[model samples]
Target: MIKKLFLLVILCSLQVAVAQELSCTVIVNSDQVNQTNKQIFKTLEKSLNDYVNQTKWTNRTFSVKERIECSMMITINKYENSAFSGTIQVQSNRPVFNSTYQSPVFNYQDKRFTFNYVEFAPLYFNPNVFESNLTSVITYYVYIILGIDADTFVKEGGTPYFKQAQNIVNLSQGSGYAGWQQTDGNRTRWELVDNLLSNTFKEYRLALYNYHRLGLDNLVDNASLAKQSIAGSMKLFDKLNNVRPNSFVLQAFFDAKSEEIANVFSDGPKVDIVKLKETLNEIAPLYSDTWSRIKY
Candidate 1:
């Protein structure tokens, strides 16, 4: 029994030493690429998965169960020589407290991804320098996912991670990458991080903490009070919408949250849905159809 305990302690220590923060699944869809050989795509999918899941992106320790759950769907719409153009759908979710339910924290699609990749090339991330487009782009989203997840637990706790993503954006500004520049379009990586760190959009960050920590996490204990807190958190967006109407982060929040929000109030112990729906509509007018369905 003593020997078994010693072995278990050693195993736990080993896991602590090697536990990376992200549990990412990567899928590279190259159906649009007219390549006959499919070995390269398979290699890319594995490389990306290994790269993201193996890299220790932060100083914080995460057990296997605590690692952030996320996925990157890389759809290569065009490929020629070593150049590849694609869109990446990045998503992440956090487990609600006292329940098995996983709440969607981020669901965003980056459309301006264009990178060059050689099969079997090693992917490495450096904070101070602009690595290749493939490395930088994926790293940016990784930090964004980490940042938003942190924000859900603590007010503006994601600042450090968001700043890491900002560093990548600043370093990659002139690298000719489509998503790293201001002119890369409104939905580029540059804009996303900028908006996140900018003081003008702090409400969205605070609301994230309130919604999860103060609301969803308490649902099992007090469903009605939790729904009220969630509604109160949603009202924060109304203030943000008035200051910066129809912002990217606002849209990003609803993109992940609309369905969940609708369902949360629809079947709960009950709250003022009329006011909650108004707040939802005010902040995310695009999700009006979703808001209209919220009852009780």
Candidate 2:
């Protein structure tokens, strides 16, 4: 019995060590870069995939089925020497309760994402320290994605994770990276995390929890109430837009959700969508084209 218990402990330890949080697909696009050596991009893609997938990002041990689904597409606009200039579009989603359908949670592009890379240099994540711009950017988004996912499950559950990303932002400041400083563009990473954790944007975070946990997760039980909850969640933003006036966080929210919102209300059991549409147009006028798809 003693030997059997020892073997069981060894197996459990291996499983805990091997479990990873993110099942992220990393893509490197070099079409814009004029380089005959395409092998470097492929190598970089493989390296990034390995780095992101194999890393133990959190203290929580997640089963393989519980891993977060996300993707990162890096478009290399220019590559010269060992320096690479590009944009990274990061997106993530979560599974709905009692359903096979996955709900889209985050979708945003970092236009000022430029980073240096030496081919085959092993990537490491030191949360307390500032490393390469490439790793800092990637790690920042990983925490953001994790934070967003956590927010959907519990009220303000993502606070700790958002704080972690904030720490990364704090550490990376003045690293000569464009997206790391307050002076960087409004849509930069610094603004993204800062807005998320700010009380000024608290509605955005509440809406996230309501839309997912109370709305999508309960759709199978009572879609009418669920749709109403989702609409009520959007209504949380009515006064917010007036204050911030088309803020970066608001834009990012609509960017990821406009289509999904339209689809949810369009096909579901009718729920006073006329008022919902009005609210959507007022807050997210940029996605009015998508909002129009939601029938009265």
Candidate 3:
């Protein structure tokens, strides 16, 4: 009996050890001319870190710890033609637990552009509606990083961050009538624009947060809600595509989501309970993989 007990304890210990966590960072590089916008990148970095660490999961599901392997740097690069770009480099130790391990290294470089607040300003100034408007931004970008459409994420029942975002958006709706903005700091205030400018890039900031918080913790439970959020995110991507047909980010989202959806159908039809369960497990990895590639 004692030997059996010892074996059980050992097995438990192994399970705990298998559930390790990972950490990484982003570095943005640009020219001195772009230095003024550096803070935006920095803020985004901090937000990503926060999402990966604190967001709680539902039903005591997967929980990720933020064990920083090293400091992350964002560099700004400039060209003679008056062009500027941003590059992000992430370094981290892999998290291994229960035969599950992830060592994700993401590197991508792209031109830097700013999203004007005027396009969405009317909703931004309202305290109640702010989160939803913010959700719109993040939802749009998370799919872009994943090579999926904002509509896709919403359709898949997007992460918890979507609900939180909706709360903000709902709160902001009627509050703008009184010219009552400035509930937050200056940078946030400025992000709340309403005009012809596109919000495609701004979505990345929100996507990172949603991925970190929701992906790590598994805070969402109701599958229906999750699907709606994912669909909403996909719709935002569609909107971006309408404005900029062949944008790099939009293309990426389309490719990723299309692959993911295709993969779900590739395994064959689900005709029985056993087959359905098997298919569900197989499709689960697609969700994780899609979210993992997201730039935040």
Candidate 4:
């Protein structure tokens, strides 16, 4: 019985060690701040790195290799007393099946991030409650990453995670924070989550699932069929754009996928080139230059 108990404890410890969902790198840049003591930024970077990497954000157990790959770059624009104002660039990616390539899932820059932090202080976050702005913002993006990664694997699988992010935005309302309100900007946290969860943009989410799983994942097995599927998925964006012209979600999708779409079709059949160019230009005229590189 003692031997069995010892083995059980070992298994539990192993599970705990491998359960975190994100493998994220956090950078704190304070070059814009004219401060002599820059050690605080270094401490902030390490603290955020530990907070994101070590914290378990989901119930699903993940092996070290399966953790979601993501990054956050915080550029401290100004420092006054204990308050810091900065912009955060957040990005996350997923590995394409049967390939060494990774696809960008989310890439956004939040310019209104302002927070208060003390050197060496622990960063704390609770999904149900609004805590410090620093932790809340980090946690919000973490769920967004998880949601987008899951949606690529399963249809609308990101709904719960997006809802979790919405809850963070809801709890943060009236906190006087810059990015939590609908009026903050077109690309505010509230608007992003709202569009993801709304039925009006359901096609956008479905297109993401088809684009990644049905399309990209099958390239190694059948390039022609995969390209066809990816082009079909791109058509869904036209539907989304028609419903809401130039929406933030539509722009965000193209922002992450423009170059990828070009590279994927850079050497495809003549039929695919015609179809892709027509559909892509119709939906994303902003990427005409990038798409022009695709050869028939």
Candidate 5:
């Protein structure tokens, strides 16, 4: 019995040591709702916190420090009985190579988040099954975060994970959810992942890999070359824009990267400044003011 107990302890320790891929901070805000049963919100918060942090969403093993840092803020707009409706804001960041700074990879908001929650009920998610909209939506974004992080490491490394997210969308076709359908809007979850994985957007994904792994990661060793590599990657966005103008994916990229891109070129070689400004205007004309701020 002593030996069996020791073995069980070791197994438990091993399980605990294998950290999940995401170190997500989940917040359940109920300020919009006028309710006396605030305890349910507290319970929901704890449950979601556990669901996101404790569940293993990928096959890769990550150390506590290596886990991807992300946050999901779900603001409750309405709460009636066990039903909750709200919006979710999600943001994720990846650490730069050999630097203390982290770069934002994904920042998005889901304005239509409606679901039913039972107090103290378990939040279950299975990629093969379409369970609840809450779990499905959360799982979808989790995979998206993973996919974006993966792309920064290797060229198209996020393809498999994006496909996984696409599968969730496909399975959720009959889910009657707002964000799952293409007709919902161009910025819907379906369009985001679909554009990311589609051939028309291949250059954009390639640019992501180059911008991170080849450009940012090499900045410490060679700033000029890194800037040039990053510039080359930026040009690909122009190509992507030519193919699919005003794409949701392109807008999303700028949403997370505009500031960083501007800063990176603010004091670079004079030639790069001209090229970057022209490309920035051509591809992301929406951010011309931001790009114009870059020092020539």
Candidate 6:
């Protein structure tokens, strides 16, 4: 009996340790990027927070009330055409507890059980170079990394939010520089941004379809389907790249999604289900991708 008691204590202590080890935050390195390009950083930051606040899946409900610490590290790459880009790092200390519970057996056999570990998925995003293309790049990363339900929100009349995001891109128009509406002659740079956004919407739809067809959550599972989906997206990316490969923001936007498409299958293309799992990763969470950028 004493041995069982000791085992229980050990298990409890282990749980505490595991919980303590799970810490997450977002870091941005803005070393060389300046105040004039601050809008890009702001847009990225908003998308990151929106992702955590809105994403649902995981079979575990995070404490929305609990404050999760996040930061950003921004740096200017002088060699890359004085390009401005940022990386978003997310760490979570709070244990994303599994809702599944095992019955407490006090006298059955004095048995001890090992703690089960849950896997966490990482975030990904590429920085945009051009101010005009920044909006599309930022928005794409938010959807891919943060898992925003862009289609549902947009279809639900989230016009105000979409327009606000558009405004961010439009701000850089004219004055001898490319704007959202301005034509760069044969360059078709603006057209590329528009195409990028259009392609992103398609990918979102594909993600939704895969989520529904295969009962999985996070990119850790069902990577093959993600690959196939991304492969299709690449066709679009290539077409757009041909138009304005020079646009850093545009190039990064497609590159980031391409990476995500590859990682979504990082855990392999299979989800666990003995018999009763939702047809489409039932725990799939819904997040409003445009809340930060849109007014409505």
Candidate closest to the true structure, highest lDDT: 1
Deviating ranges (above 4 Å) for candidate 1: none
lDDT of 2 at 107: 93
Q: Scored by CA lDDT, what does every candidate get?
A: 0.90, 0.89, 0.34, 0.89, 0.89, 0.32
lDDT of 5 by residue, 1-296 (tens): 99999999998778657888888899999998999879999998899889988888878878777889999999999999888899999999998988988899888888989999899899998778898998888988999999999999988999889998999999997888788899887688899999989988999899999999999898888888888889998889988888888898888889899999888887745446777789899988989999989987
Backbone clashes for every candidate come to: 0, 0, 63, 0, 0, 32
Superposed by TM-score, candidate 6 places the C-alpha of residue 250 at a distance from the truth, in angstroms, of 11
Residue-wise lDDT of candidate 4 within 1-296, one digit each (tens)?
Answer: 99999999999879757769988999999999999999999999999999999987878888767788899999999998879999999999999999888899888898889999999889998767777999999999999899989999999999999999999999998789899999887789899899999999998899999999999999889888888878888889888888898888888888888999898887754345777798888889999999889887
> How far is each candidate from the true structure, as Cα RMSD in Å?
1.1, 2.6, 14.7, 2.9, 3.6, 18.6
* Shift of residue 193 alpha carbon in model 3, Å: 18
Per-residue lDDT for 125-193 in model 6, tens only? 222333223333334222222222232222323233334344444553442333344355432334433
The 10-residue segment with the lowest total lDDT in model 2: 120-129
State TM-scores per candidate.
0.97, 0.93, 0.28, 0.93, 0.92, 0.31
TM-score computed on alpha carbons, candidate 1: 0.97
Using lDDT as the yardstick, the better of models 1 and 4 is 1
lDDT of 3 by residue, 140-183 (tens): 22222222112222322333423443344335444332111345
Looking at model 5, the pairs that clash are none
- Which prediction has more favorable lDDT, 4 or 5? 4
lDDT of 3 at 73: 44
